[model samples]
Target: MSNKVILVVLDGLNYQVARDCMGYLNGLIEQKKATLYPIQCELPSMSRPLYECILTGVPPVLSGIVNNQIVRLSNEESIFSLAKSQGKVTAAAAYHWVSELYNRAPYDAVRDRFTDDETLNIQHGRFYHWDHYPDEALFLDAESLRQQFNPDFLLIHPMNIDDAGHKHGLDSRQYRNSARAADIYLSNYISTWVDAGYQVMVTSDHGMNDDLSHGGILPEEREVPLFVIGDTFTHAETTVKQTELCGLCCQLLGLEHCKPYAPEMIAL
Candidate 1:
């Protein structure tokens, strides 16, 4: 039998900010209702490349999606494709790049903004084009999709944190506020999702730097947070890798992992 999973990518969130600002998530950790694991993201720590890395379990060097400017459908097998091929439903409420990578290439906002075609890798989608799109709206969109489609695997990605980091720098008040706001919205929905038997993973594509940018060797650009809410995890102290997320998703959904993955990430 398959299980339901929701992966929430809080784009451009740095580990320090997440550890300090996401109060509700931290509350869960304090209450032992969730587990927090700080993991280093894949290089060059850019958004688009790490997006592919997180979903496909392939590094930028191997996937060739090394930068944010590379706009093309992914050549590697991804979580969405793997789920779809196994007769499972997949969905995402994320940045348009996700649609371009999996559903269609060269995304046309008018035609590709909202997709529900069963023929596509991402069978259902609610993609946003704006970097500053409100995170609450995106979560509501994801909740709406969950209520309607009940997809086996769902990707809920919000970009406001990344947007603030870009405009205000990592240490600015705006960036921290953005993280806090996202945590508040997550507090509203996570309990219902957990009660509904959905395994949820909230993490980031990459970190942000004090220079108001990313895609470099700085620890601020590479370190991000991972929070797991499910019964499958051991809750033990173990090292986790960013690329292992794909395999972990496959494990949650009862699908075979398509690429090499680190078993200790999930420790199932």
Candidate 2:
């Protein structure tokens, strides 16, 4: 456990939504338990693009990821690849694209796929697409994996907030509640990792619009929230960009140095 790291992406949480609904996270920010940055995501502001951007430290235009429709990752030196090369185990519990991304990697990944009545067993804590709580299984699955595999790097992407946003739009009661629900679920996982001397980095892929839709570069859609917390985390006042996220994770996890996307934003 020399370089343990947990990266949690809350999918499509806007900065304002997180500030308003994620009370525990806010407490960390206010008390300086964590560093919070309102950072810039790429244009198009889609999950796939932002995910790739954060992983490769490359912009969407250069990485060839522009929207939800695209999934191919051209950048060879990803956080996953770097960790895997160093003999560090990596695991991810997330959306289908996660499987698509890790198809060839040695990483263990569980997708929050849509399930049927016969396939989904609530007694086993599994649910389906229409359940509105499909992501709860993700956290449970991740915990189980953590105990069994003892992975060095864990990436958890919860989808409930994204679902709620698309269905009811931002500023709706459902949207805010969904954000809170994600916060609650993430708190459990964060505590588990921190107790084991792991560093945690939480960020959003993109923000949302009035209709909770995101596909452009408007400030609301492009500004995502970032939080890095751990026992060894430095307390500093600095802003960061979405592309700089990969470097930040690498630095915190003691991995090979990846240059910051915005050199000016890094804290000395």
Candidate 3:
């Protein structure tokens, strides 16, 4: 595709929060020349399972990643491994447990375990913990990893918003504030990468309710946003609901041979 891609996941963030913070994100969207969508996440909508689905492009049934704390490994498949085989370098920066699940060669730079509070800051208008390992550290780490290994794909997960939402509620002022802060970081990150000529695909694994509870049968838990902006992709206002976002990623990367679960693939 001739474009490096970065996938940014804002944990537990909903459309409302993102829309409210659109002013911050819109600039990055314009700078990167990207598009936005409201994509659907899988049921239960927990972090580990949903992220696995996103990276592996397979559902829990096939990927064997059904929960947040468990690891499912089979000899035959892994998106990171497969991407490596295809000569694409892949890198990721995620919260503790999710990073462990995707430990593979091509996907480098997995962050060690950090508590939710340690990685996030809800006070002062919600910003990432820049004291220990700033957001720039992760971005620079990804950039360095890419420079050394030249990975074709990069995935980043920021957990402050999600953690705050879980502890407080999605409707809580804390959560919204966190979302706004996340938007600022995201915009800055996107601006930096897209300026470096990388296509940015921003999405989430799933959504959380106003009360910050998921893993249940609720539309709020399953609906998420999937937006793309880059030189390689087209821009359009389209909706892809209840569809597995993993498959969409595969399609965009021209790796559609990956097997996705039923109801995981939807057309916009």
Candidate 4:
């Protein structure tokens, strides 16, 4: 297989916020290791639905993911399962649902869920959330898991920005500042993988409107940013649908996407 892949999900980041807040990302862009794609997530742009879009390359309407708590995935192919078929080791640091989708089967012992329980846990502070955990904490967890498993494919979801947007409006100073913080954290975390000869990917589940809520068709809430960075493979994508990511990830890993679900290719 190709060098390992690290997929970083900056939950609920909008394109404008990404441009203004994520200054460090330009480092990768300059290396031609990064490409910014303008994408509008599917309707009901909540975590589960939009995540399904990135993971399965399908929209919420077809994926049938209405809420974050629903554990049952649609009868569709997923990147994790595809990676397994390629015999690539996979791991994920994400919400509870991620554990549900990619539990034990092919996963090794280093594969397990983590809690943000500060003291009893390894790193997360007492302020962790039940639904989403901050990137700060997930980064620590991902590092530990990676060191142990050295997985071929790793999916990470850092979610404080989503929480900030929900508790405070997207226009609020908190949301903007949190978006910036998200950028810095991801930049630092991904660098380790790049230094270790791994490909890095950064994207978002959905966007947030001024009201701090999604699930609509507004550009602010629907548009997200996708960035891919690596030394071995560096290319640009001017426009791409959100549904195309799953197939793209599989392709990057040197594997085939599920039949009939090819990711829309961008003209280089």
- Which candidate number maximizes TM-score? 1
lDDT at residue 167 of model 3 (Cα atoms): 76
**Superposition TM-score, candidate 2 onto the true structure:** 0.84
TM-score: model 4 vs. ground truth: 0.83
1-268: candidate 1 lDDT, tens digit per residue: 2288999999999999999999999999999889899999988999999999999999999999999999999999999999999999999999999998998999999999999999999999999999989999999999999999999999999999999999999999999999999999999999998888898999999999888999998999999999998766667777788988998888888897666555564544
lDDT score, candidate 4: 0.70
lDDT per residue for candidate 4 within 64-175, as digits (tens), equals 7777767763456777777776677777777655544434222222333443321221122112236455567777778877787677777878888878888887788888
Misplaced by over 4 Å in model 1 are: 262-268
**Model number with the top lDDT:** 1
Estimate, for each residue in 1-268, the C-alpha lDDT of model 3 and write its tens digit: 5435677777777765676665666664666565567766775578767766676665655566677666543333445555555555566665544445544212233223321121211000111232234444555555555455454666677776777778777678877887777666666566667667676777777667766677765766776666666666656444554334544554545553554533322223
* Model 2: CA > 4 A from native: 104-133, 261-268
Which should have the higher TM-score, number 2 or number 4?
Answer: 2
Q: All models: lDDT?
A: 0.92, 0.70, 0.58, 0.70
Residues 80-187 of candidate 2: C-alpha lDDT, one tens digit per residue: 767666666666666655544434222222333421121211111121223255677778877876776676777777788877888888778888898888788877
TM-score to true structure, per model: 0.97, 0.84, 0.75, 0.83
Q: What's the best-to-worst order under TM-score?
A: 1, 2, 4, 3
